[model samples]
Target: MYCNQPPEKPGNKKELLEKITNMARANSLWVTAYGTGCGAIELRPLHTSRFDMERFGIAMRPTPRQADVLIISGYLATKTLKRVIRVYEQMQDPKYIVALGSCTINGGMYFDSYNTLNVLDKYLPVDVYVMGCMPRPEAIIDGFSLLMQKIKDGRAQGWKHYKENLDYYRENQKKIITDWDLPDYNW
Candidate 1:
């Protein structure tokens, strides 16, 4: 039973601007969804009124450029990894990734498949990983809540890690993607 309570006001005497910026960032997370596998089925229920994800400030965006969060809802095949990297690069600064499903975490049932990526974090920084064969809509909501809390606390700095370690991520990516010809990042 994970609690989805809103983050408490920080009592730390931090800069007002930074606090406000994080508040805004945490409040409005535009998601770029890559519903690639079984988790896709689970993600759809979020859009319907039953889950009602919008009240929590999580909404879907069609393009990565317009989104702040990338939800990778399934396993990463070698081919899918390329597109995921491309999309991650296109997103704005201070972005975050919320990976769902055990497959995306450790290849799950696809661990034996040579084309399946065993560990997603090897290629890109993953901020939140919701475990389970297919995390239920409630669990996905809990994941988003966790991410929001991280953002508000300034703990969700995976984007910074990715930027500082771009070469490392790229190297790992290239090891699997043989015919790599992705464009340079817009940074």
Candidate 2:
């Protein structure tokens, strides 16, 4: 798509290019790694010096509020769904969600499992979907690049999108299993 990408402003193509290049070099991406499954094991290379995502302005953060990107790495069970929504809501505006595996995209092997959600998009808006049983470090880096472009252009309207669809989300949230549903076997 960059072959003949249009300039941000007709009179200052060079300036636009520079702005994009700078963002790329800033290592400015703040990621909250929500590792939910075995797929998270693949994130090791991205965090380590081998892939060194730090070079792309993408680094892990401890809190969602401090994050600009939320990486859903692996399958999410029904019990974890609520926590995911809470965390996603806590993030600052313009945040992006990256589904890091086939399991997250379609539940992979857990498609038939009652506890596994079919797709992360069912609960959260996903900006980029990385397809693999587990995506490689390079794929993750590429996803980061895509996300940076979106952030730079101010196209990720997470807050507005969620607010408009709050009721739909609330109804979906209600369908998920709860602790109250567990039978009182101990009793």
Candidate 3:
């Protein structure tokens, strides 16, 4: 059942196929980079020659529909959280979330701010969390690698959990996003 283990044969053919598919999906992660605050600047170096995230099969997608990963790269305001939730929902199933910077973890400097939410997991399930006010590109790359491993291990099931607990997530999102302008279902 371990991710690094080779797929078993015969009776476990279906399971073996699933494991192979997961490995392929994990290796080819198309990211939707949504930078909501100051940490957005750090992502710039990822595309440059120095970091070059593309080398790891991590490329940026123009739309959420085409992306397999959603990188929430900074502080999330109430207004922005609404949009973030919408975008996250729009992405296909088996998606992963990478929460970068201290802001998304515990609100960072905005911990006491009225418009910001301290913990991201309360509304959206986060698969990987890269700590620091603004994590370096190396840390971001590491986070992505960790996420890939999680996907391979079948531990990155946040999307499936969200679908099964839609009402609970919606209530938490609605509590902070008072305006509630979006429809009941994002799809």
Residue 36, candidate 1: how far off, in angstroms?
Answer: 2.4
TM-score of each: 0.90, 0.77, 0.90
**Over the stretch 1-187, how does candidate 1's per-residue lDDT look in tens digits?**
1112323344657567777999999999999977657788898999899998999888899999889998888888888888888888888777999999999888999999988888899998999999988999999999999999999999998988877777788899999999999887354
**Could you tell me how far off, in angstroms, the CA of residue 17 lies in candidate 2 after the best superposition?**
16
Residues 61-103, candidate 3: write the lDDT tens digits.
Answer: 9899999998888888888998898899788777889998998
- For candidate 2, write residues 1-187 as lDDT tens digits: 2213322332565768756754653348788878877778888888787898877767889898888777788898888877777787777755678888888888898899989999777677888778887788788778777776766665555545655666566667767845433222210
Residue 105 of model 1, lDDT score: 82
- Between prediction 1 and prediction 2, which has the larger lDDT? 1
C-alpha lDDT of residue 88 in model 3: 91
lDDT assessment of candidate 3: 0.85
lDDT of 3 at 115: 89
What lDDT is reached at residue 38 by model 1? 71
* Alpha carbon lDDT of each predicted model: 0.86, 0.72, 0.85
Top of the candidates by lDDT: 1
TM-score of 2: 0.77
Itemize residue pairs with steric clashes in candidate 2.
27-57, 28-57
Which of candidates 1 and 2 reaches a greater TM-score? 1
Q: Model 1 — TM-score against the truth?
A: 0.90
